[model samples]
Target: WLAKITLVENQVLLKYFVISASLAGIIFLKGAEGRICKTFSAISRLSNY
Candidate 1:
């Protein structure tokens, strides 16, 4: 039935949204870590100088 099809489509869309959001979160976390590492390295170099 049309109603069943709509429900299935909605579920698929919801799953896709969840997966994309999780991926975005992981990317953001990695970016933050990279920034922190770069900052620490810079501080170390400055201290050495």
Candidate 2:
């Protein structure tokens, strides 16, 4: 019974970890995309000038 409880706890912890990791990955990707867009716009402006 105790082993079963531990197994369940491990599963829950794994689920939480996976969720948090994915959220972090999404945020990182969005940040990188914004940076790239900003850089592109800056380059465009420079070229225009």
Candidate 3:
């Protein structure tokens, strides 16, 4: 059970990190900031829950 929980947490952390890294790409892109931020926030909320 402990290992399983840790794995899930790791997955969430990795996903969170990737989304954060995506910010740089989003900044460079033409006009996807809104969508990217929306997805990022949604995923963050899910991770918190």
Candidate 4:
């Protein structure tokens, strides 16, 4: 039935959206972690000087 097909399409679209959002979140978290690490290293070096 047409209704069943529409439901399936909607489910697939929802899954894709969830996957993309999770990937974006992971990338953002990694970028934040890298920035924090770099900042810490710089602070330590400055302290030594």
Write down the TM-score of every candidate. Answer: 0.60, 0.64, 0.41, 0.61
Alpha-carbon deviation at 48 in model 4, angstroms = 11
lDDT of 4 by residue, 1-49 (tens): 7566787799998999999999999999999999999999999999999
> Which has the higher lDDT value, candidate number 1 or candidate number 3?
1
The Cα error of candidate 4 at residue 2, in Å, is 13
Better of 1 and 3 by TM-score: 1
lDDT digits (tens) for residues 1-49 of candidate 3: 6666787798999999999889867777746777789989999999999
Q: Spell out the clash pairs found in candidate 4.
A: none
Q: What's the best-to-worst order under TM-score? A: 2, 4, 1, 3
Q: What is the C-alpha RMSD of each candidate to the true structure, in Å?
A: 4.2, 3.8, 15.9, 4.2
Top-TM-score candidate index:
2
* Residue-level error in angstroms, candidate 1, position 10: 0.6
Local error of candidate 1 at 46, Å? 10
Show pairs that collide, candidate 3: none
